[model samples]
Target: MTISRRILLASPVLAMATPASAQGDWPSRTIRIIVPAPGGAGTADNLARIFAQEMEKRLPQRVIIENRGGAAGNVGATAAARAAPDGYTILWTWAGTMATNPAMYSDMPFDPQRDFVPVVLLGSVPNILIVNNDFPAQSLAEFTAYAKANPGAINHGTTGNGSSMHLAAELYGQRSGTRLTHVPYAAPAAATTDLIAGRIQAMFNLVTGAQPLVTGGRARALAVLSPERVPQLPDVPTAAELGMPGLAFGTWFCLMLPRGADPAIVSRLNALANEVLADPEARRRLEGAGMALDGGGTPERLAQYLREEMASHAELVRISGAKVN
Candidate 1:
């Protein structure tokens, strides 16, 4: 064959090899999944454990989970962003870090959209609006009435600034037309301690965060944030049932990787996550803890959700005038 014909034949083969070359054998080494929250928390720990176990079974190498908490999840998220984008390090975090932090803080070292690619939406849980059992109100309606009568006299607790707990409480006040006093803490553990001690009368916190207190009669969950009552708290009504249609809210967690990671690797991670979420045993464990798996659409959908949330919460934060250092 002539030299030109030989060169043409090799061009297609070279082009085909390029993609295979770029997509090199992924998970050739151990992968680190960074949990922005501490290891003890149900959402972070559960997801990390489940995914790591399943990924180990499916992938070529082991997956490890590391806890890096502080600064409302910024410390760990920032660390994940700075890590190499070779699919070795992943950031598994809740919505507070990606959706609410930008509006609350002036300087976050990494941008949620710019610095990372969404792998999959792991799960979401409806937070319950609860108060110490000794508080005056018995239900959400009563609580609203009491707050309106007292105005800024009622102090409420939340996990921290820019958390779902914080924003949910703000939304409740905004809709109810009451200016409830907000007390922010570093984490739910501290806030729960205060709630049990009667230091704060109310909190719109995670079910897992307040489950013990509620079960033990230390606090009363008067209303849930979902449209329907959670199975765990059958007696409590939803916010929508109390004449509030637009007040539905939930806390969600997702896995994200630094931008520029290979698409093949992202796909592999998401697929492994979906399998873990689909497992009947895993689903039972998660739901038993008040969390539900949300293994849905592509990473693009998650990115869109973040953008919409950023826009939606920006307006609310401006109106609420909630600020943090």
Candidate 2:
């Protein structure tokens, strides 16, 4: 598969019909996965499209992806939250939408916990520390020391205030006891351009976004803020290996249903999701794109994970002071 084709699905289902099939032949018609982001090349859209593409091949009914982008995912999330609680409408989103947006925006339209039912976690992409090759630091250890020595010398580019990228950078700074000036961008592509042109000294870029640059020699990857090394960039060290376990940062993707979805349908979808996620090809493609398919499949696990992530993101947002409105 091509690099774009090998990436993870919209963020990240289905099984058969013992009990869930009884629900008026659930999924008798088209099932739509609502991706709360713009369509095209980004992680949110590609992940959703490819995921649905794979599932569509097996499902008896058609599986389609719907893009609803704006307001940093609030627009699409609200649309999902308001959608009918039928089995057909599934919300495909990530930690930024489900976990961090609440902390960033004051008038969030939907409560991630209250308005939706957890379906399954798709995957996660860790934020790896990358610096311009021209910068002084060559390794994570040296980078931290340099940041400490020159508190405001480093300029770290991020997608925007309170974005997953910004939060990861804040977490890294907090854990490393170093300071960095924030250079927030409207999008990661622009920030990436700036990083390459020496406009910014560093970035806590997602592994998917950072891998090619590191491999192409545009940037030097120092450490991944994850528990383990990603398949796409195995040569980079992890934060734990660098003795900075507290810097662990990742943006996990998940699937959810609008509130009031039928229990039987939920069960059916969850089962199918588990089966699809466990497939070796799915794992290979997702992992190859720097996404780890280690997300817990059960709804109970997803709920607990959401709660934990929300709490962690809240703290990080407070520390970063990245309010959206």
Candidate 3:
């Protein structure tokens, strides 16, 4: 056969092999998933580790996590956004970092929509209206009645302005015609500690984080700020069921790739995430930890979810007057 004929035959084969070869070689080294929160029990960090462990089982490469926690998740998000979009580096973050931060802060380092491509929404934890066991109110009715009588006398603790807790309380106040005095804390732990000490009257805490407090008799959940009751706290009725359907709030998390990541890698990781979340053991652990797993949708869904959350949170910020800056 002529050399030209041989080259033509080889061209198509090379094209096909090149893509396969690239996909195979992609994870040649360790893959790192960046958790934009603290490690050692931080929800995002813990969740990231779960996925990383499962991803390692599937991929030939090792999957590791790097916790870059600080500045309300902006520090880590910025780092991930600036990293090369070659799939080796990724960002596993939550609503606070992507949706709330942009609305809260005027000087954000990265644009969530422009700088990252979503892989999937991991899950969410509902914010529960928790109060110290010593507080007078027992139900939403009693709570709102007490707040209305007291006006801004009730001190509600939050991590900071525009945090899930703060905005949730603000939303409740807006809908219920009651008022709360916002007290900011450096972290949720501190706020919870203060609540336990009776230094704060109430807080909108994540169901998982508030579980032990409720069970231990340190605090009690008045209502779960979700449309439906969560498995973590099955006994707690949803705000909707309590006749305040609009008083819903929660934080969702997602896996995101730095912008321009390989489409093949996005698909592969999204598939792996779905598999990991679907695992009986993983699901049990995550659900037990307060997450409602929703891991299988397309990346586009996550992107759309992010947009919707941004708009919602922007309105929350407006109503709550929450400004981190």
Cα lDDT, all candidates: 0.74, 0.82, 0.81
Q: Which candidate is the best by TM-score?
A: 2
Clashing pairs in 3: none
Candidate 1 deviant stretches above 4 angstroms: 1-24
Model 2 spans > 4 angstroms off: 1-24
Q: Give the per-residue lDDT digits (tens) of candidate 3, residues 1-325.
A: 0001111111110111112224556788888888888889866677678778777888888988998988889999999999887788979888889988999898999999888877877788778999988999999889999999999988999888888888888889989998899999988899999999999989998777888898888998999887678877789998888889888788788888887776777788788888888889878878767787754566766776777778878988998877867
Worst 10 residues of 1 by lDDT: 1-10
Per-candidate clash tally? 0, 8, 0
Q: What is the lDDT of residue 264 in candidate 2?
A: 76
Tens digits of per-residue lDDT for model 2, 228-288: 7877888898888989867778778888988777767787778888887888887676676
The TM-scores of all predictions, comma-separated, are 0.87, 0.92, 0.90
| Model 2 alpha-carbon miss at residue 292, Å | 0.3
Whose lDDT is higher: candidate 1's or candidate 2's?
A: 2
- The digit string of per-residue lDDT tens for model 1 on 1-325 reads 0001111111110111112213467878898989887786556677567667766877778889999987878999999998877888989887677877888888778898878877877667777898987899987889889999999877888766667777888788778898888898876788888888899999988766766778788889888777566767777787888887667667777888877777777777777778878878767776776775654555655666666667767766777677775
Model 3 poorest ten-residue lDDT run: 1-10
Best by lDDT: 2
Q: Per-residue error at 261 for model 1, in Å? A: 1.1
Q: Over the full model, what C-alpha lDDT does candidate 1 score relative to the true structure?
A: 0.74
Off by over 4 Å in 3: 1-21
TM-score of 3: 0.90
